[model samples]
Structures are given as structure tokens and as C-alpha cells.
Target chain A: MRIVLHIWRQKNGRSSGKMVRYELPDINSHMSFLEMLDVLNERLIEKGEDPVAFDHDCREGICGMCGFVINGTAHGPVRGTTVCQLHMRHFQDGEELYLEPWRAKAFPVIKDLMVDRGAFDRIIAAGGYVSVSTGSAPDGNAIPIPKDNAELSMDAAACIACGACVAACPNASAALFTAAKISHLALLPQGEPERHQRSLRMVAQANTEGFGACSNVGECEAVCPKKITLENIARMFRDYIGASWTRRPAGASRG
Target chain B: MASTFQRTLRFYEATIGKKALIAVTGAILVLYVVGHMIGNLQIYLGREALNAYAHKLHDLGPLLWLVRGFLLLAVVVHIVASIQLWLMNRAARPSRYVRQSWVKATFASRTMIVTGPILAAFIVYHVLHLTVGRFHPGFNHELDVYHNVVAGFRNVPTSVAYIVAMALLGYHVSHGAWSMFQSAGLHHPRYMPIVQKAAVALAIALFVGNISIPISILAGFIR
Candidate 1:
């Protein structure tokens, strides 16, 4: 198969970027998108030209490190599959593909296709965890969780922090990513103690990171690799609103 | 005192806070639209009934002014917050997509940014034409309420503009009403579909009810 690629190339974060074209005449149908990129980089290296720099690790798609917009759809045209897992067979022969990095104020382009997603880490650090004492692992049977609750928590927990939701959203909102984290923790008994505080902190951190507001467009859910639902965003909103009202002012009277 | 003010400012600065403001203010405006439609529907009941209703509303004195003031505030807040959100959304994505695709968003949701400003402009024209009798030559201030409405809609261009504005209003309210729930953090999976359906119904009802007046006059049914 022949593929014409117009890849975004940049020297650094401050450098101006442009789409540079390359032609690959013998692409295998069975090769993954990242593997196809590997072939292109090898060819570029042999030609003494700079190779496109994109982030990837654990090509199995679980690490969430691999992503770049292919033809404007996050993780390619197929839904619920990461870029690393997207095979070349899905595309037609003699296809012209337009590749670009995830565009967002928070996610600045580092090199060619790589963008800084550290803002997600900061949001998670804000309160994406439950506080527990350092001790031996708790007995699984000791704290019995409802079956439905456990499944719901696991479902929300499937988010890979890939930044696809932010990438696909027209507003560049991180509501889906932040909400997945909030809902995952809030659904469990262990995460109940600091639920209000977590919601408030995480939401405030996300806003501070320069993300836009969610308008219920559902684009995030559509492009989500894990198929995370927009319901988590609603749940996060519910928690955030509740927290705002019940949260006490510093040094205010407890009575 | 300063700290309290700062706290309030910070609350509104957050995206969620701004969204909640839009939702609450949007709800107020929706209520006013629905009430206005019901009141205007009395035009079908003949001149005495509709004009008597209008006079009765005016007879409320300061209470009427209070309601009007609140509605004015709501409209201002809703528009300001929405514009700010639109600008922020644009700033977030400095680079536009070369090939964009829509998956879940409807035409109404996508066109809100366009329809919103148009509706705002239409409101200005509507007020000038009907309320102040400034835009339309046929507008008569001394005439009864029913007579003023019928005479205003009797003009071809004015009636067409009114009908077009009402259609845009229908599109705006359809998405706005559904989105207000999510904005207000009132979205639940089981009930969201119901909310969306109700939004569509309300939008259709408002469109039909409001457009009926101008259509009736143009068809000589209201006269």
C-alpha cells in the first residue's frame, strides 16, 4: 500500500511548525500506526533527515503515552482504539493522511508530534487519590463493596489519561479526564471520606490548568479510547456543586 | 469585606461556576419566554381579553418593574457568561483542525454560538418595533394591545422577520434547555434523555405558539 503523509514537524516548543510531506510506497497492511511511523523514521534517518519525534511506550496501548491526531480524529478513524493499536489495514491504498499533535493551551507541542501533558499529572496530584495509612494491604473481603458500585468504579477507572478527550473536544475541555478520576474515587467507600474535598480540589486544579468548560457536546466520550461515558462528567459536576455549598470557610465556626 | 468579594469573584472565575451561572440565568429567561407565550396566546381570545390582560399586567405598578429588572439582569448575565465561555473556548484551541468531524453534537448544539448573537440582535429589533414603536411605521402606541400586535404583524417584512427570529429561538432553546441541566450539575443518565425530549417539546411549543400570532394576522384569522 502507498501512503502519503503530511506530518507536523517542529524543532522545539518555541519553534514554528509545518506539515512536511513524505511518501511510503510499500506499507504493510498488518503494521500498526506506530510501526508505520517507525518505518518512516528509519527511512528519514537513512536519508540523513530529522525523524519525527512522537511519544510512545508499551505499544500495547495501556501506558497512555502514545497519541497524535490522524486526520483530525483522535487515535484515528476507528473508535475505542489507541494509535498504537490502529492497524494500517483500516486505511485505503494511496491514502493521504494529515497528522498533527494534540492542540490545547495546556498541551504545548514539545517537538514534532509530542505535546506536554504534565497538566494532567498536576490535576491528578491535586486529589485523584484516597488517604490511607501506610500498612499491610487491607483484606479484600473486609470492606464489602456492592457489585454494581465496584463495576462502575472500574469502568470509570479505565481512563488512560491519554489526553484524547481534551484533544477531541472543541472547547479543549478536560472535564472527561478529570471527571473520570473524580468518579472512579467517589464511587468507592474508601474514597468517601475526602469526597467533597477531592471534588473541589480536582475541579479547581483543572480550571487552573487553562482547560475550557464542558458544554455537554459528548465529543470527549466519542473519541475516548476506553469508551468512558459522559455520565462521569455529570457525576463530577454533581459532586463539585455539592462540595461548593457544603465546604466551610477557613477558620469559620464549626457549629 | 474585600476577602468576601474576592471569594465570590474566584467562585465565578471557575468554569463550573460560570456554567452554573449560565444555567440558572438561562432558566429564568426560559420561564419568561414560556410565560410571555401563554400571555400572548390570549390574542386568540379577542381584543377585549388580550388588551385587558395587558392592562392588568401594567396595573401591577412597581411589581412589574421589579420583574422586568430581574429579567434584564438575567439576560445580561446569560449573555456575558456565554460570550466569555465562547472566547475562552476559542483561546484553548489556537490551531484549528484541518479536517473536523462531529460525532455526538447536533446541528443545534454546534450552531449555538451563531444563533445566540443573532437572537440577541433580534431581541433589540423586536423591542424597538413592538415595545417602543420606534422601528416599525405601523406600530401604534395609543392603540389597544391587540390592535398594536395585529397592526405590527400586518407588515410583510416585519412578520417575516418575526417568524425567522422565532425559528432561531426554537433552535437556541432546544439546545439551551437540554444543556442547562448538565451546566447546573443536574444531569443523571436515566433522566437526561427525558430532559432532552422535554427540551425539544418546549422548543416546538414556543415556536408554534409565538409564530401563530404573526401567521394569524397575515392570514386574517386574528382580525
Candidate 2:
């Protein structure tokens, strides 16, 4: 099958970018999207041209390492599938696709289709951790948790931190990503001690990172590989509001 | 010790806090518009009833001023929060996509800013034309709201503007009503569909109720 690609090319963060077109005449429908890109890169290297740059590891979708906008939708057109797991079979012959990096002030471009998602790391570092006593593994049923709460917590924990939510949001808001992290902890009993502070600090960190506030457009939920719901966002809001009005944390007071 | 006012200031500093303010003020405004539309629908009762309703409102005296004052505050805060967030949202994305397509976002959801400012402007003009009688050439100095409304809608351009503004208001409220619940963390999966449908229904009711006056007057049914 033949495919036409219009991919954004940027040498570095400070450099300007533009769409560069290439045609792949020999492409297999069975290959994953990233594998097809590898074939294109091989041809580019054979022709003595600079190969396209993108981040990927563990070609499985679980890594959350590979993604880029394809024809306007993040992680390609397949719902709940990462670009690394998105097979070429989804596309028709003689199709034209546009690929671009995640465009957000928080996620700067490192190279062609490669963005620095260090902002996500910084947000996680802010308060995505729970404090626990270091000891041997406890019994699984030691902590009495409601079944519904456990399931909901696991749902929120399914977030892979891929930055697709940020990429897909019209305002470039990281609300979904931040909300997922906050909701994951807010639900479990182990995450109780610092629940309020977690919401406060993590949200503050996200704000300082210059992400847009969520207007609840919900583009993020639609493109999320984990199928995280907007319910997580609502939970984040509940936590944040409760924290802001009730608790006078020392760190937040400094602001 | 930080004062309560200081704590409130600190709360308003975050984006969520600002959004909360927007939601609260938006709720006040939404309630006011709904009540205002219901009151206006009394024009079908003829001149004396509508004029008496206007007189009774004016007779509220200080209470009327108090309500007006609170509404003014709501409007100011709502616009300020919206503008600040709008600027931040724009700054968050310095460069837009070369080719973008909408997936789940509705036209009403995407064009809030556009519809918002126009609605604000329409509010000012609407007040001048109807309330203050400043823009009305057939101004009646007395509390003859029925005459004022009929005379106002008699002008072709004025009626057209009112129709257009009502349509935009419907679009704005359809997105905003549902959005307020989300912003306030008041949404639940079970009740969300009801909230969404209610928003649309309110928008439609406001549009039809408000615009029906102009249409009735222009069609010689209200005269």
C-alpha cells in the first residue's frame, strides 16, 4: 500500500518547524504505526537524509512512550490505542496522514514529533506519591477497602502519563493528567493522610507549569489511551475545592 | 494571622478558584435570566398587567437596588474571571495546529468566548433600549413597559438585533449552564444527562420566550 505523510520537522527546541512531505510506496498493513515509521527512517538513512525523531520504548501501548497527532487526532484515529499499538491496517491505501508533536507550552518540542514531557514528571514529583512506612509486604486484604472505591482508584491509576490528554485538549490543559493522578490517590485509604495536600500541591505545580485551565471541553477523555473519564476531573475539583476552603497548609499559605 | 479576606484572596489566585467564581456568578446570572424571561412573558396580558408588573418591581425601591447591585457584582466577577482564563488559555498554546478537527467539542462549547462578549455588548444595548429608554425614540417617561416593548420591536432593525442576540444567548447558555456544574464539581455520571438536557431546555425556553415578544409585536399580535 502507498501512503503520503506530512510530518512536522524541527531540528531542536529553538528552531522553527514546518511540515515536510514524504511518500511511502511499499508499506505493509500488518505493521504497527511505529514500525512503519521505522521503515521510513531506514529508507531515509539509506538515502543519506536525517531520520525523523520520535520517542518510543517497549513498543507495547502500556509504556505511554510513543504518540503524535495523526491527521489531527492524537495517538492516531483508533480510540483507546496508543500510536505504538496502532496498526497500519486501520488506514486505507493511498491515504494521506499528517503527523505533529504535542503542541503545548508545557510540552516543548525536542525534535521532529518528539516533545519534552518533563513537565509531567515535575507535576508527578510535586505530590503524586504517598507516604508509607517502609516494611515487608503486607497482606493484600490487610486494608479494608470498598470494592467500588478500589475499582475506581484502579481506573484512575490506569493513566500512563503519555501527555496525549494535554495534546488533545483545545486549551492545552493538563487537567485530565493532573486529575487522574490526584483521583488515584484520593480514593485509596493508604493515600488518606496527605490527600488534601496532594491535590493542593499537584494543582499548584500544574498551574506554575503554564498549562491552560480546563474548560471541560473533554477532548482529552476522547483521545486518552486508558479511557480515563471526566469523572476523575470532577473528583480533582472536589478535592481541590475542599482542600482550598478547609485546610490552611503551610506551603499553600506561602503563596 | 491571615484575615478571612486574605484567605479568600489566596483562594482566588488558583485557576480552579477562579473557575469556581465563574461558576457561582454564572449560576446567579442564569437564575436572573430565567426569572427575567418569565417576568417578561407577561406582556401577553396586555398594557395594564405588564405596566403594573414593571411598577411593582420599581416599587421594591431599595430591595430592587440591592438586587441590581448584587447582579452587577456577579457580572463583573464573571467577566473578569472569564477574561483572565481566556488569556491564560490562549497563552498555553502559542502555536496552533496546522490542521485541526473537532471530535467531541460542540460548536456551542468551542465558541463561548465569541458568544460571551457579544452577549455582554447586547446586555448593555438592551438595557439602553428598554430599561433606560435612552436608545428608544418612542420613549415613554411613565412606567409603560408594554408601550416601550411594542414600540421598540416595531423597528425592523431593532427587532432583528433582538432576534439575533437571543439566538446567541441561547448558544451561550446551552454550553455555560452544563459547564457551571462541571466547574463546581457538582456533576455525577447518573445526573449529567439530566443536567445537559436541562441546560439545552433552559436555553431554548429563554430563546423562545424572549424572542416571542418581539415576534408577536412585529406580527401585530401584541399591539
By lDDT, who's the top model here? 2
lDDT of 2 by residue, B121-163 (tens): 9999998999999889998978788999999899999999999
RMSD of 1: 1.9
List residue ranges in candidate 2 displaced over 4 A: A250-255
List the global CA lDDT of all models. 0.90, 0.92
TM-score of each: 0.95, 0.98
Task: Compute the lDDT of residue B176 as modeled in candidate 1.
Answer: 94
CAPRI quality level assigned to candidate 2 from its DockQ score: medium
Cand. 2 TM to true fold: 0.98
On residues A1-255, what C-alpha lDDT tens digit does candidate 1 reach at each position? 999999989899998899999999999999999999999999999999999999999999788999989988889999999999999999999999999899999899999999999999999999999989999998878988899889989999999999999999999999999999999999999999889989899999988888888888888999899999988888898888777766666677462
For candidate 2, the iRMS in Å is 1.9
Residue-level lDDT tens digits of model 2 in A143-172: 999999999999999999999999988889
Deviation of model 2 at A29, angstroms: 1.4
